[model samples]
Target: MDDFDDDSFNDVLGSMEMPTSPKKPKVQPSTIQPVPAATSTANSSNNTSASITVAKPASNPHSVLVHSKQRGNPILKSIQNVPLEFRDDIVPDYVVGRTSCILFLSLKYHNLNPDYICQRLKALGKMYELRVLLVQVDTPEPHNALKSLTRISLLADLTMMLAWNAEEAGKIIETYKQFEKRPPDLIMERVESNPHQKLVAALTNIKPVNKTDAVTLLQTFGNLGNVITASEERLSQVMGLGPRKAKRLFKTLQEPFLNK
Candidate 1:
């Protein structure tokens, strides 16, 4: 449901890359139930609604889920780092992470019809916490197309990614999948220079402590040394240091010297 137009969203056949021998993945046949003819009686009229059912897809562990439409795309085959499984029901080109999806777009195809992205975005509005618009610069001049998508991405809360070729996009998609369950501490700076900086870093590491509370501790007690010797009552006297945080700070600061 794109905001730009009222025309119903019909699935546009996706063929970003050239056909690769036209081999299709086998899918279980979908079944549909016929609607019963409407019946009219003197008291009331009734109509039966039809129902449809499709087989559920089998999930793989530590794997990326791909859309069947992207079967022939080079990105589908290039994701060699992690396993991938194809499913037709997904909206995005690649389901890279549990909470993330990627929509691959080619600039050359949409150069004449730029609003096509608007329709795609409308279909993908805020579905995932991390949405990536993986755009391929497939045209001689892609500046105008990128400009439009960039503006829309801001409004749609999408992370716009630029890749010169399919290989790079594949790598980016694979990276998202691999890092999905990983924590950011690997990339976080655990050490900082300067007492002022270290003070904040150290205190903030405690569950209930933060920069403001850390600064309050430093201001109330001269330094880390004084803080360590101070009683829990004195520690709790600092602004914002409630009984819990203050007791936690005192316990942490006075952790046995052998353990330290």
Candidate 2:
């Protein structure tokens, strides 16, 4: 029922492979940037001053903040265009946006110590709204590691990103930073108008078909799936469809979803 061909793909390799993730920096939370100034106003009636304080969010909109521990990481050198600043106070590897952060691990290292990611995830503990457990697959077979990471992602509410190599991994990080402020419509599925109209429009787009014929097929078959599964002979039975047109529609529907 699915189209996955796992045998066709292999894990990626690189000269920058590290056997273990960098150790967590020994820094205090107080190292974060100073708090934003508060507004103080005097209430003349009460003869008392009141102050309103709003906590400043830790994320930077312009540049991605990286942990100092990742100074030697090859991924950092691949990230282009976006500015990167190093810090030691943050827990995650790369702070890409306001609520997003990445924790990187390589399969080479995960294989050495299977439970390492689990301990890291436990310490991470739902800190960022968007926590990415980015894994670089450096081994020949990565399915077992991917499976474990996938399960961990589900349990820890962390998003999992699998990178074939360090260059691709760096590009992924760069993309997250560059598009962090862009609207989601760039990648979202574009919906045009209502469902019924959209379906009719789609069918009419095929060669030798029209709006009236499209609507007729829908009415006759009850739904899109049923219409697609209907036989060419049954389609010819419809009021407007001829043998040639019905055959075309049936053949088109049966075509492979992909060109290859």
Alpha-carbon local distance difference test for all models: 0.64, 0.66
lDDT tens readout by residue for model 1, 10-58 = 2221211211233232235365432111001011112212222222343
User: Model 2 over residues 195-220: C-alpha lDDT tens digits?
Assistant: 99899989998879899999998998
lDDT of model 1, residue 204 = 88
C-alpha-based local distance difference test score of model 2: 0.66
- Model 2 misplaced regions, further than 4 Å: 1-60, 192-201, 204-245, 248-260
Candidate 2 has its poorest 10 consecutive residues by lDDT at: 35-44
> For model 2, what is the error of residue 19's alpha carbon versus the real structure, in angstroms, after optimal superposition?
28
Query: Which candidate ranks first by lDDT, i.e. highest?
Result: 2
Worst-scoring 10-residue span by lDDT in model 1: 36-45
Each model's TM-score, in the order given? Answer: 0.53, 0.58
